[model samples]
Target: MDLLHHFPHARQRPLRELLAEKQTWVNQDKKGFLRYRALLNELRHIRATWLDLNSDVVHIGRPSDLSPADRVHLQAALCSLKPWRKGPFSVFGIEIDAEWRSERKWNRLIPELPDLSGKIVADIGSNNGYYMFRMAFHHPTLVLGFEPYVHHYYTFNLLNSFAGLSNLQNTLLGIEHLSLFPESFDVIFCMGILYHRPSPIESLQALHVALKPGGSIIVESQAIPGEEPVALFPEHTYAKVPGTWFVPTATCLQHWMQRAGFHNIRCFCAHEMSSEEQRQTPWMEFESFQDFIDKDNPGLTIEGYPAPRRVFFAANKN
Candidate 1:
């Protein structure tokens, strides 16, 4: 599929330029690209008879649609993309119970979501397009997902190929690329991405620049427990995740949005993370939240840091 064709005409030229630069970096690992190409080639042949995005488990096709041999082939193809991080998708009767029960998080945010009908939306760090697929039910004019990892980018493409959600599109891009989309989006979902950035405030600033006037940004992040407006700059890793940087208090996160020039900032939800929310599963059999936290004390991580908590906030551009 010509991914560029899905983008708006006004963005086509600059997006082309940006993708060309990205291609240069991608080309450095020709073998990995070849592997991804082979995977996509294998996936294109399998098509879903029907799909339902509105369900808790995003359902695609049914068992009756595929022969026994075809089901085996499909399962093998999906298993190749291991460590599924953000989903509980059922594709053609084969269940993919991913590491995170993403539906739980989705349910928390849905009540607070702005009406998305005909709006242009962006989901930053949209791993495997789980949220993007869910957002499709809202009848958005367009829902573009930005996920930089090649594994996830291809996974989303493969799923969409069968589900065929015309309004849902994805790109091999991350939050750093938000500058290319100045004032282009009506709503941006920046979930589970802020704490990963070394400079959280600057990342929020980029999100601010990407929104149209009066646009809203919904931010969900790993936060520390406290009422004080301060952040925990981890000396090393937080919850055994090395990429984590500043785990902020709920108040501190709101303050970050305020500093980023967002107005009417409101924190709608705040809750501690749990094994039930994220854990090892058949589809994602690896070290999970259970292994990261202290068995003796759930309130603290294995590294002795405050245990993981996720906080959700919504703010608007002036």
Candidate 2:
């Protein structure tokens, strides 16, 4: 409680304070936690009394997050960087936008994705191998990445080299060249590259070829969301101009999975944003995040994924 009270906010936190400042909600949570703790203890005692259970019940002190040596090192690091701003930016972009975000986000995708324990994985359209690296970092098993862009393939190779991830293997290939894979890998990450293909369904069929039966795919794509399909991702859809490709809503996405010889399928609505929110987001592909800093007028910035928000789908090959 003391540590939480003194914990610092590295970046601006507006919504957190606003929600907490409301006296009605604040009073409820404060009173609620105490009452809940008391109720839990009472329940425990009652159960113990009924069961005649007692081992001289003792209170165990919870361990601190930072050990004594870790605290010492942390203090030394803090002291060494006295003024703190060695580089241009003081806070990361994620930190700045943390309060504006909802709980449902892409950050959880990598962790909540199915376990790859004793499993091989494939990362399709593995641009610079971001999601693939996540699998390799967490599971440390064999991973294969298929990338079409030659420069991006080399960049992925370089990043893998620096990461020293020995189990990861990659080749310069697209969904079209998936015949190179002999129908293996337990899990596949298909993210940020789905809508780029002219026929998204065709790409899914190709991805299915690389995955073993019962293998799974965790997907995140630029979705065209509405009651009916429309031309939303036309201008900067990335693959082709006036792109005829369709980004299936959650319902349509499910239908496609069933048709693709996949089963036991489910989906997650990963990214969500309002029209007003979309305009505020910076474009990482164009320039560094710092280059687009409009701190004085955050609302004025115009540019980004236009049709409000997008969604991702997670499905299986079986």
Candidate 3:
């Protein structure tokens, strides 16, 4: 008998919840889906708190002022998503700062990151050369960063010049241009950047060609954590806002990875955070989140902030 038949009620509630959630999410109007907007609201609130207290706290752009086109660009940046500045570490444009950390820091994810020394790696959509700077310092790898923004290119290059980080190279091209290359990299990172494009899957396919058959790619994305994802663009917000295809679940991420011809996929969440870290870090803006959740779901007690966010998925091109 099918294992699913053995436990008939196993997926019933989750399935029902997911279906209803999707329906409601799709029905949301203008401002944004109740769910995602809540996440943003809490983030904004936390950001305000952080800025008031922490003098050195880094902040990205505000979402409200974004044009529909810019919103899509922001989605691609995954720029709005968190884990923002990798804890204030720097040197030689390389992070010699003690705060710099690897996936190893987030024990909940069980990230199997390899030593970057001496391998050829591709940093797709390298915003501000954050990853490039880090890898340039510790891992002896030849890292190439592809970023389309001119200002970022200039700033990153200037930093590279000052730090004299020979291991890192910056380019002003989109991942779609990967077709120009015939060789493969030892590793490719597509972090927080795919959602902006009209074709995230196509971007994935482009990476497949850019990678060695067995090379791996790190995919970090913003997705609806519980139930199902709610679409913000289709419902409203702005006329030119591009839709963010939130994976909605770990399984959904696995599906996308599989379709991209990646193998041996792994996934994880941030919710497995330590208790103190969860409560102490004010970024877990629950009060503001509750307000938005309450607006869309008055009868429900869905506290949004601090909810598990953005899934981490990785797999090999093989």
Winner by TM-score: 1
| Reference-based TM-score of each model | 0.94, 0.54, 0.55
Predicted structure 3: lDDT: 0.50
lDDT of 2 at 149: 55
Candidate numbers sorted by TM-score from highest down = 1, 3, 2
lDDT of 2: 0.48
State the displacement of the C-alpha of residue 229, model 3, in Å, after optimal TM-score superposition.
9.6
Residue-level lDDT tens digits of model 3 in 110-195 = 34554566777888878656567555544645777877664455445543443455667766666876654434577877776665
- Indicate the worst ten consecutive residues by lDDT in candidate 3: 46-55
Candidates sorted by lDDT, best first: 1, 3, 2
Ten contiguous residues with the weakest lDDT in model 1:
1-10
Query: After superposition on all CA atoms, what RMSD does each candidate show versus the true structure?
Result: 2.1, 20.5, 17.8
**Candidate 2: which stretches are off by over 4 Å?**
1-106, 228-244, 273-308
Tell me the tens digit of each residue's lDDT in model 2 across 1-318.
Answer: 221121132112542343245323323546543443333333221111111001111111112433455445434432322221111111101111211122233355645577776677777776545445445545646776777554445444533433445567665556665544546557877765666677777777777776777878877665554655443444443222234356566566667667666777766654544433222232122232233323454322233323324666677765
- Any runs in candidate 3 off by more than 4 Å, and if so which? 1-110, 227-248, 270-308
Which 10-residue window of candidate 2 scores lowest in summed lDDT?
46-55
Candidate 1 overall lDDT versus native: 0.87
Clashing pairs in 2: none
- What local lDDT score does residue 169 receive in model 3, on the 0 to 100 scale? 77
